[model samples]
Target: MREAYLASGLTLSDLSVQVPLAKSKLSELLRGIGLYPRWEIVSRLAALLRLPHVPLYRLWRQAAFEAHKSREWVERSTDNTTALTTSPAAPPLDHRAFCELVEADYLLYAQTFLIDDTACHNAVGDTFDILWLTWNEALASPDTRSYAWTMLRRTIMSRTPHIDGRPHFTHAAFDTAALTHLTDEQARADHLTETIALFQVMGWLPPTQLDVTVLRILWRMPTERVSELMGVPPALVRSSQHHAEHFLKSALYPTDNEGRTP
Candidate 1:
């Protein structure tokens, strides 16, 4: 469709006169970045492109069938895991059920590491689109779940902007700034508060370290998996994680002037 549209020298906007579809919407279908389109829209697009409708419809059906099979594979693969591997593609389902089953997991994870609601949604949205388009590949290999998971991580790392690490808050700084209370209850509250604050502050870290820490350290993904996602060596993934851990420890749990827990 894309090739035909280009070859015809008619922009999607120009073709919109002949078909009742939005140019951008057509692009989504042509790119396969979105869910299935209505038959009328598909037929219109094929006709406008001077392509035979039946063959194009058959192609759509084949992709949809593969997408459905992959959805079943994902559901089965996810049923056995603690954290849902973030693959966005699934066969169309009841809207409420879709959110409960698929969208919630990624949203929760995104909220945990991102700075705000916009960042959270934006962080997960691109991955969602990519997965929605290509997640069927998950069913092809023996390491089905792992392959799906690696794709998810790579999606995140690829889309997010990099942050260069500079000196930032460490745990020791916070400890000195706030005197520890005498009671155990106060101590626990302070601990919980600081731990959460530390997580939010991750948004300010180098994006690479943030990716490394979230994938390699917090998620406990294998170094090789993180490496593949970040497009770096496994050793560097480990090293980035190591440095990220050290930075967080210093920022979230500062020691006293005497080198003791305050």
Candidate 2:
């Protein structure tokens, strides 16, 4: 309701006048849903938002159904409604959780891609030149490169669904396998070196601080874990994360640069 009202450029007061319910009661209804305006208030708020009420209502109903289904899946082990509804190959992810994961993946990928691309574009030398040097120095033999590629392929494959109709949720398994395979000191050193080089090329880190802290935090930690690691309050972490995300997008797809908004 608030999102619709804001998008329509109308205040709650403006909406209250058009609705049948008293403003105070409308406010209470909205407050019940983490919004301040009641449904009666937003009854005409749809028009202000330039959206028909019927479609919006339908969308809201669908969202509510999905939320209810997700909760049901979490609470009742016997119920496999969601699993049965989705394709067998698709992981039995709770709808809300899967959406959140997908959103985070998109944001992280965009940030990393932008930072890397920009660094490569500004370099006086060939961008992959550093990657090649790092590979040569870190890898003991030609076989090492093949091994690394295999490790990478396995990790990617584990997260992805098989070509066959097998139903598997491979993320946890994939991480375990990757960590186990790359636990050797030499492999760890090589990975760290390559990661640092890539970050340097992306201007995400300086030579003095080769750890790529932000990327590590984003990749290795959950949002709540990131807050704990940063040692700030959760709210502050959220604010900082949002600002950092905006900065990354701006860096990658500048306003003056023609193309998508990112």
Candidate 3:
């Protein structure tokens, strides 16, 4: 989409005014950054680009299917796209029920890390869409919840921007800053400095420790649920959280050159 927009010689501002979607969302669409867009938005953009509607809709359908959107919902979103594709297999009721049950958990997990509502929602929706595609396999597994949780993590992690091969947490700086109720300028600055340091240290932790820290400390999910989602024993979850806290303390409060606490 970015390539198409570039080739068409239309500025982002032009596309923003022309398309029905918001400018920020349009930018995300063009960059392929956020949730897979609904067909109507894409179709209008394609029309503006003089791209063939049928071919674009086919591509969009495949993406939407992968993102876990229902065929019925996709069809309802745009008649033109619906006409271009054959009817898809309906998602099972069991899968639907599973999605309803875990969607909030998935959203909370994503938001606690991603920090952007759109990206968080997209990750959750994509997780379910992927689980729907693999429902039979998930059912065959001894623990369906575990299998689905793995799928959800994969979906979210892939979308999570990384720094030096670790999950990036610097994006959370804005939200972290917003949490402070400090009124003094110096105090607020002090709080933000520590918050950013903590977020950066979080990105440096080993993956398992990072996951445990986020679930147990930041999101405040119960240890049992964290254990299930991570496919780890509850004891291990507690241990990891303990180690993560230790690491954070060391990283954020280093000893001085003479071995004295700073």
> 43-143, model 3: which lDDT tens digit per residue?
67877775545435555776777789998978887865433223244566898887887787778778757767987887787677666645666999988
Candidate 2, pairs of clashing residues:
26-38, 30-35
Residue 181 CA error for candidate 2 (Å)? 4.3
State each model's CA lDDT, in order.
Answer: 0.55, 0.39, 0.75
The order by descending TM-score is 3, 1, 2
Pairwise TM-score winner, candidates 1 and 2: 1
- Best-matching candidate per lDDT: 3
Output the TM-score of candidate 1: 0.41
Candidate 1: tens digits of C-alpha lDDT, residues 185-259: 777667657655765567566766876776665556678755654457778877888888877877766784349
For each candidate, give its TM-score against the true structure.
Answer: 0.41, 0.25, 0.63
* Superposed model 2: Cα runs more than 4 Å off: 1-21, 29-44, 51-63, 66-177, 180-262
* Root-mean-square deviation (CA) per prediction: 13.3, 22.0, 11.9
Q: Which one is best on TM-score?
A: 3
What does candidate 2's lDDT look like per residue over 1-262, in tens digits?
A: 4544545566568766666666666566556544333223343544544444443333333344435645343334223212111113222234224234333433342333333433223221221222222233225544432333333223223333332433122222222323456868988666555444333333332211211234334365565654433333556556655655454455545763556553
Q: Which scores better on lDDT, 1 or 2?
A: 1
- In model 2, the Cα lDDT at residue 213 comes to 32
- The positional error of residue 27 in candidate 2, measured at the CA in angstroms, is 1.4
